[model samples]
Target: MKYYPQLTKRQAVSALEEFLAERAPALERFRQALRADGRDPDTLLDGTTQGLVPLWGWVLSGLTGPDAPACTDPATVPHEDWPSWERFTAETEAILSYESVQLLDGFISYLVRVVEDRTPTAQWQIGQHPNKRYQFRNHPVLAGADRQIFFPGPVASSAREVVRGRRAPANDEMAGYAQAVIEALSAEETRHEPPEPLVEVEDLGDHPIRGREIEVSLREDIAHEYSRQVDHMVKTLAMEDGITRVIREDREVLLVATPSWNTTQLQEWVTQALRDAGNDHS
Candidate 1:
């Protein structure tokens, strides 16, 4: 409802084209180096026509910037193990799950700076379309909230494939800002309208416990305590009657079917669980 001076969709798309064109030589060099390594650039399988751009972005700063992390202590780190800037790419977590996120995010970070430099007033964010269930952890569009821009990129498809494996909870704060973002992204990649938030319910029609027995079961389960994440989630989800917490394998776990659970609630619940577990005895 207020006027903004940052990039519009058309301008953002044009800017991406310009950025890619300027880096065309660098991109070509990248492909050639990959080919020489016997790694076919065509089959990079980054789930984009752009080919290996994610990897290139992951190592872009090291290859081109003064801030490369490879400038480590020479005696402690072997020269042979140091990153070869000439190659234009280096390894990180090579799996798609990590690739679509860290690798693509690195590239997106580069793009954001480029966008910022060009449009001084611009602010950008890279994240999922919460309304999207078949979504990736990192979608290709760089959202410029100030000017209703979604600077789309090759990062979308492959990232989606990775996200399809494990769905994360939607962020309410993000949703408050991103409804228009999905509209500007490719139709195939986003929902036309935001979907109503849904929660999972278990029938428990013929299960072993019911009525007062359920409350007794819950009280028995609560005796074995967990940690901060538990305290945090209990404070968060204690009023959601549809949910149940139980100890499994000596650990606190929620008993609802994952797909049917409140994605946000379960996400907060389990994330803390994992964090608590990982910190256990450490």
Candidate 2:
């Protein structure tokens, strides 16, 4: 999707209000249809309703493009010319069976997206070693699950300076201070230690253990060495179609299977482990 020009929070909010107002008549008609059909109008319009997608899409279409209104006073913008109420009602009546909550949810989700797109990703600077200009830009963290706008390539001391100067800087001023601190820290040539590696176990086999309970205990001496292996085995059992709960305490692991799990498979896995361990020792 083409990135729309960024808007300040206030502007974005005003634009959303205007967009909603343009669609108010049709949305109200949709609500009336729900009430007439013996559905609670208020209860039906929530985040999970499916009918809101097309409506949100229509709203977005108007907000994008070169001819799109500038982020000025909404009152000054010409009102969108909507289709007559009779025509709109006839078209929307076919989909009145869908829940209203999902439709509202779609609008909310799109609004959030529009606002975030305008949010500055980062602020930083440019220059030579000592007198560099500060800047800011968006950097991805948490595997892109989250993003923060701050000075790129900042050192520990500089980061500390940035943090110390402002416990929480205003949005507009954050970029410069963050970049300045990062540059100062970089000049100090601070050293950083590598992060610790994460240890995780993966499932090795599939079985239906959804609701069955089982416990296994390991000797303390071998717990560290075999914890990963044990964890993998437990996960395999837990993932079985009906397994519901898995609990671990020190060297012991417990599992609970729901009706969907196959207890026989659990038994077989345990027996196989015993045989494998015996063979290894022998």
**Against the true structure, whose TM-score is highest?**
1
Q: lDDT score of model 1?
A: 0.34
**Residue range 71-136, candidate 1, lDDT tens digits:** 322233333332221111223222233222333343433333334443444333323343334232
In model 1, residue pairs whose N, Cα or C atoms come closer than 3 Å (at least 3 residues apart or on different chains), thus clashing, are: 200-260
Candidate 1 lDDT at 162 equals: 32
The lDDT values for all models are: 0.34, 0.34
lDDT of 2 by residue, 1-282 (tens): 100112222232343344344355545665565576576656545422232333333322222222224423222333232222112112222211122222332333332222233333322211111111212111111011122222112222222233345323222232333333333433433434332212112122335543334444333334465666666666665666656666664553344444544445554554465345442221
**TM-score for all models, in order of appearance:** 0.24, 0.20
Candidate 1 regions with alpha-carbon error over 4 angstroms: 1-110, 120-126, 130-141, 145-282
- Worst lDDT 10-window in candidate 1: 211-220
Model 1, residue 166: C-alpha shift (Å): 32
